[model samples]
Target: MASRPRPPPPAEEQVGQSLSLGEFQNVQSLSLSAARMILHAMINHRQKGSKDGSIAMPETETLNKTLDYLELFARFKDQETTQSVENILGNYDELDTFEKSQLASLCCVEVDEAKTLIPSLANKISDADLKDLLDQIIAKRQFMDS
Candidate 1:
């Protein structure tokens, strides 16, 4: 009888400690912070618009770009980072100055914040990458309850 073939290792099991170019390239697509910021911005922005003439939904382009980035990140989750979003961001080279500035403005959060995000988030997200933010907020809630 022929021997059984082995299955490939999971993404979390991939070799090496640092990010390769392939890894970095894979991550640019999605960002939790970016999505959350966009969502929040849309909500806040809509609230400011006058109710008079016409009501427009959040800008389609904003949603599209944010979703594109997030979906990309989500897709890569299984193929990389052991499906850990924190690992993905942690190992990457980070966003550029313009991107960073845009992110900072959108999130009112710094890149350092990504460093502390929990790995439980992995690929799931909506408008902003709030996995970390949400986790942190929850942690605070526990502290407050105590």
Candidate 2:
């Protein structure tokens, strides 16, 4: 008898009320600010570990490009502000981890805008609650900038 062929993988990843992250299903999602902090800390640790106290360039061109992109887009520059944003998002237990991260990274100002960007958020949170959350995030951002 012939052996059966294996099934093909999912055609695309989806993130709505249900997440279909494919290979990344178990992976923890991170906000851009958090990713930036982690990458910077890792570079600092490498620098500290080296004899010259200076880190080498990122191992790959992709990593170098990623670092540059994060530098340009990461919203929260300081740890305190990042933590505040995380805390605000964390309070909304209904949100998925991906949703929380997207909220922090995108920094959407309006409920409709957030819902349009992260469709899963539409059914999970009411407009008033989302507006309140956005306001809090905006306030933190303003404080950081000032």
Please give the clash total of every predicted structure, in order: 10, 0
Query: For candidate 1, lDDT tens digit of each residue in 1-146?
Result: 59888876545522122323333435443345444545556666676774644675656786778666755442222222222433333432433322322222233233244433322222233225544543433343344346
Which candidate's lDDT is highest?
Answer: 2
Q: Which model scores highest in TM-score? A: 2
List pairs with backbone clashes in candidate 1.
12-82, 29-69, 30-69, 32-129, 33-129, 35-127, 35-128, 36-127, 36-128, 36-129
What do the candidate models score in CA lDDT, each in turn?
0.40, 0.87
What's the true lDDT of residue 3 in model 2? Answer: 86
Tell me each candidate's TM-score: 0.25, 0.84
RMSD of 1: 15.2
